[model samples]
Target: MNTFLYDVKTKCPVCGREFTYTKVRMSHLKVLERRKDLYTKYDGIEPFFYDPIVCPNCGYAALSDVFNNISDEGKKEILSKITTNWTKRKFSGKRTPQKALESYLLSLYCSQLKNDKDIIFAKTCLRIAWIYNILNDSSNENRYLKISLDMYKKAYEGFEAYDGEIQLIYMIGELNKILGYRDEALKWFNKVINHPDRKNHSLIVNYAKDEWQSLKI
Candidate 1:
C-alpha cells in the first residue's frame, strides 16, 4: 500500500454497494505551481488523479464533491444505462494518467446522462482538458477546453446570483485567454473587475486584474 494514498469507504448511491476508493494524503501534497486556468502542478503524486470517484460494483462515476448527491432520476438512469453493462473493475489502487483520464471521462458521461448542472459539466470538462494538457496532447486539450467554455457560458447565462459566481466569471475569462480569444477574455476580465461583488472576492478580483492587464500589453 502506498503511504501517500489511503482507501476511503463510500456507499454507491446508484447501486447501494459499499466500496473504497483511493485518495492522496493532504500532508503529502506539494504544490509546485498553479496555472491561470486553475490547474495545479504538484511535486509528488498528482491528487487530481483521484478527484473522480468510480464504483467498482456499478459504473456510476462522478467528482468526489458531487458523488453522493445524485437524484432519484439519476440513479434510475445509472442503473439502466451504466450498471447493466459495467464490468467488475477496481479503481482503488494507484492510478496512471491513462486511468485518471478514463475516470474523468466516465464522470463526464455520467454527468451528462443525469442532466447535471452545467457548472458540473464545465468543471469536469475543464479537468479533462487539464489532463490532456499534462499529456502534451494539445488537440484534445483544446477540444475539451472548448466544450468546458461553452458549458461555463451556459451556466453564467442561467444564474442570476449564486455562490462562487465571481469565481465562475473569472474562469470564463481565464479559459478564454488560455484558448486565444483575446477580445472575449478581456471583456470577461473587465466584468469581473467591475462586478458588484468584486470586493467580496479579492483573490479572484486580483487575478482578473492581472489577466486583464496582460491582455492589453
Candidate 2:
C-alpha cells in the first residue's frame, strides 16, 4: 500500500463480497486551483485516484458515491451480464493512474449494464476525462470529454430526476467551450446570465460573464 493512500473496506453491492481499495488521504490533498474546465488541480494527491472501487472477485465496479446504492434487481442484472463472464482480477494495494482509469472504465461498463441514468454515466465519463487530462493524454481526454458532453446534454434535455437545472446549464456551457462549441457555449452562458435567479448565485453568474466575455475575444 502506498503511504499517501489508505485502505478502505467496502462491500460489493452486486456480489456481496468484502474488498479493500486504496483512497488518497484527505490531509495530503493540496488544492491548487479550480480550472475553467471544472477540474480541480492538486499539489499532493489526487482524490479522483480513489473515486472508483472494484470488486476483484466479481468484476463489479462503480464510483464510491453510487457503489452501495444498488437494487436487488440491479445485482441480478450485473451477475448475469458482468460477473458471470468477468475474469477475476484484484485492484488492491497502491494504485497507479493507469490502474485508477481501468477501475473507472469497469464501473462505466457496469453502469451501462444497469441502464443507469445519463447523468450517472456522464459524471463517470467526466471523471475519466479529468484523469486523462491530468495524465496529459489529449487523445483519451477528448474522447471521454465528447462522451461525457453528449450524455450531459441528453440528461439535461430529458432527465427530470436530476436537480440543479441552472447549474447543469452552466456545466453544459463549460463543456461546450471545452469542446470548442463556442456558439452553443455562449447560448447557455447567456441563459444563465439572463436567468431570473442569477443574482442568487453570484459565483455562477460571475463565471458566466467571464466565459461569455472570453468567447467574444
Candidate 3:
C-alpha cells in the first residue's frame, strides 16, 4: 500500500527560511500494534517517525508542537549556535529509522540549546528512546529512557499542573520500574494511585493499578 506521507511547507523559526518537511497523513495510518509503553507499530509508515521538522537551511529542528513557538531569545540562540554552523541539508524525502533518530536527536539538542521546558526535553528523549527500542538497541534505548525519566522527575518537581500531568506521573513510575528501580517506582506508583487527579484520568489510573498490582505479584 502507498504510504500517505507528504511534504508540508514550513518557515524556519530560527532563520526565517522556507522549507518543506515530510509528514505522514494521520487519516491514512494503519496501526499494526501498540506496545505496553504505548510504542506503536504501524502497518505502513510510522507517523511518529516524521514528528519532527528540520529546517534544511539551518540546523534548527523541533517537534511539531514547538516548531513555531520559538521565543525571540530562542531564535537568537538557534541562530548563534546552530544556524551559524549549519550547512544546507535536506530531510524532506522518505526517512529511514536512522534518519528519524537523527532528526529527533537534533530536536533534543535544539530544545536544550533554547532552554525549553523539561517536558520538551523529556518528550524528545522519550522519542529517541522509542526509536532505539525499534532498532533493538537496548543499551542506547535505556540510556535515553534514563535521561527522559530524570527530566520528567525534574518537571514534576518544579512545574505547575498542566494537561496530561497524570500521564507524566504515571510515566515516571513506569520508567522507574523498567529501569529496575523498584523502590522508587513503587513510590511514584503509590503517589499516582493516591493522587486526586487519578479519578479524572481513568486511563492512567487503570494502567497504574495494573502496574502496581503486577509489581506486587
Candidate 4:
C-alpha cells in the first residue's frame, strides 16, 4: 500500500452503498509545473489520479467534490443507466495513469447521465485532456481540450453569476490560446482584463494580462 494514499469512506448517492475511495495526501503533493491552462505537473504521485471517487458496487463515479451531491432524480437515472450494468470493481488503491484515465471517463459518463452543470462536464473534460497531456498523447489531448473549450463556452454563456466567474473567463482565453484560436483567445483575455470585478481578482487579471501580452507578440 502506498503511504501517500489513504482511503476515504464514501456513501454512494445512487445506490446507497458504502465504499472506500483513494485520496492523495496533501502533504505529499509537490508542484513541479503549472501550465497556462492550469494543468499541473506534480513531483510524486498524481493527485488527480485519485480524484474521481468510484463506487465498487454500483458503478457510480464522479469528481470527489460533487460525488455525493446527486439529486434524487439523478439517482434514478444512474440506477437505470449505470448500476444496472455495473460490475463490481474497486478503485481504492493507488492508481496508475491508465486507471486514472478510466476513472475520469467514468465520471464524465455519469455526469452526463445526471445532467450535471456544463462547468462540471468542462472540468471533467479538461482533466481528461490533462491526463492525455501527461501521456504525451497530443491527438487525444487536443480532442478533449476542444470538448472542454466548447463546454466552457456553453457554461460561460449560460450563467449570469457564480463563483469562479473570473477564473472561468480567463480559462476560456487560456484554453483558446492553447488550441491556437488566437483571435478568440485575445477576445476573452481582453474581457478578463476589462471585467468590472477585475479589482477583486488581481491574480487572475495579471495572468490575463500576461497571456494577452504573449499572444500579442
Candidate 5:
C-alpha cells in the first residue's frame, strides 16, 4: 500500500478545534496495483522517490502530492476524454506513452505565437524519445528525438533561458550518442560544458562528464 505523511493539525473538519501542527502518516487503504511508470507528459525521466510534505503546525496536511494520484479507472477515463477529439471514443484507447506525447506535440504546433506550452510539449517529445531509445525502439526514438531537437533549436534561437538552453544542447548530445553520431555528440557536450550560461545540473553535468572522459580514453 502506498503511504505518505501529512500535517495532521488543523481546525478539524469534523469539529472546529484548531490544534498545533503535527505530522501524521497516511496510507492508501486500498492498494491499487497500478503500473508505476512515468506515463505522462512533462514528467522527466527519473526514479520517483516520494518526499511527502508535512505541516506540523496544521496537524492535518496533504502529503506526498508531488506525484499525481489518479486511479487506473480514473486515468483511463481522463485519457479517453483527452483523446476523444482525435482517436477512438473509448476509455481504453490503447494509447502508449509515446503516442500520447507525440499527439500532444502535434496539437501544440499552432501558427499563432508559441509560449511555454509549446516548449513543454517539446520536452515531452524528448522524454518519449529518450524512453524509446532506452527501450531499443531506435526508429521511433530517433524520429521523436529529431522533432524534439528541432523544437529545442527553435527555442534556443528564440529565447535566452539558461536552463532551457542547457537542456536543449544536452538532449541533442544524448540522442547523438545513442545514434552513433559521436562527433556531433562531442560537439554538443562540449558546447554545454563550456557554455558560460549552462548550469551544473546533476543530470546534464554528470552525463557530460562521463561521456567527455570516455571520449578521452
Candidate 6:
C-alpha cells in the first residue's frame, strides 16, 4: 500500500474520480482542546471537533485522519510537552513560543551569572530557532541563530571569559555543523574538550564528538 504523501482530495465525491489539484502543505495541524490533560491522553478528536487547518479549494477534511497517522504514544508525548511548556510560560508571562523559550532560558541562567557569562542565551536562541526549524522555515531559523550569536556576544561580557568556554565552543561547533562548516565545527569541538570548562555542563556535542573521533581527524 502507498502512503498518502499529501492530503487526499477527491474530485467528484459521488463518481469516485481522483482529482488533479495543487497540493498545499500548511503549517503543523494542531488540535487545541479545552482540557489539556485529556488531549495529552491522545484519545481522539478531543472533547469537541476542531479544525487545525482547512483546504483552500475543495474544503475536504478528516480530523481523525491526522490523529490516526501518528501513533497514540507520539501524540501523547507532544501534547504533554506542549502542556508543560505552556504551564512554564504562564508563570514566565511569555505567551508567544519565541518569548516562552527565551523567558525559560533566562530564568535558568538567572542564578549562574558571573563577572563573565556566555552560552546561556545562545542555547536559548538555538531552542527558539528549533520552533522554525521543525516547520522547515529556513528564514526564521537563520534569523534566530544570528540573533543567538549576537546574544552569545553579550553573554560573554564582563567576567571570567573561560568559565563557559566548553559550552560556548560546543554551541559554535553545532552552529558551524548546521551551516556546513565541518572543519570549523571540528575545531570548535576540539577547543571545547580541551577548554577548562570541559568538566562541567557543555553544549552536549556527543554526536559531533563521536563522528569526529571516528574520522580520526
Q: What is the TM-score of each candidate against the true structure?
A: 0.95, 0.90, 0.93, 0.95, 0.47, 0.39
2 or 5, which is superior by lDDT? 2
Best by lDDT: 1
Q: All models: lDDT?
A: 0.91, 0.84, 0.85, 0.89, 0.46, 0.42
lDDT, candidate 2, 70-177, per-residue tens: 777878888998888999887877667888899889899889877778888888999999889878999999999899888888988985344467666788899999
User: In the order shown, what is each candidate's alpha-carbon RMSD?
Assistant: 1.4, 2.0, 1.7, 1.4, 12.8, 18.6
lDDT of 1 by residue, 1-217 (tens): 7788999899999889899999989787788998777788888678889999999999999999889878999999998988899998989989988999999999998998898889989989998998898899999999999999999999999993336788899899999999999999999999999999999999889989999999999
* lDDT tens per residue, model 4, 39-82: 77778778878889999898889998888888888888888998
Candidate 3 TM-score to native:
0.93
Cα deviation of 1, candidate 5, in Å: 11
Off by over 4 Å in 6: 1-120, 153-163, 197-208, 211-217
Query: What's the distance in Å from true for residue 184, model 5?
Result: 1.9
Report the Cα lDDT for residue 128, model 5.
60
Candidate 4 vs candidate 6, lDDT winner: 4
Total clashing pairs in model 5: 11
lDDT of 5: 0.46
What is the C-alpha lDDT profile of model 6 across 86-110, one tens digit per residue?
Answer: 3321211112344334433433232
Which residue window of length 10 is worst by lDDT in model 4? 159-168
Of 5 and 6, which scores higher on TM-score?
Answer: 5
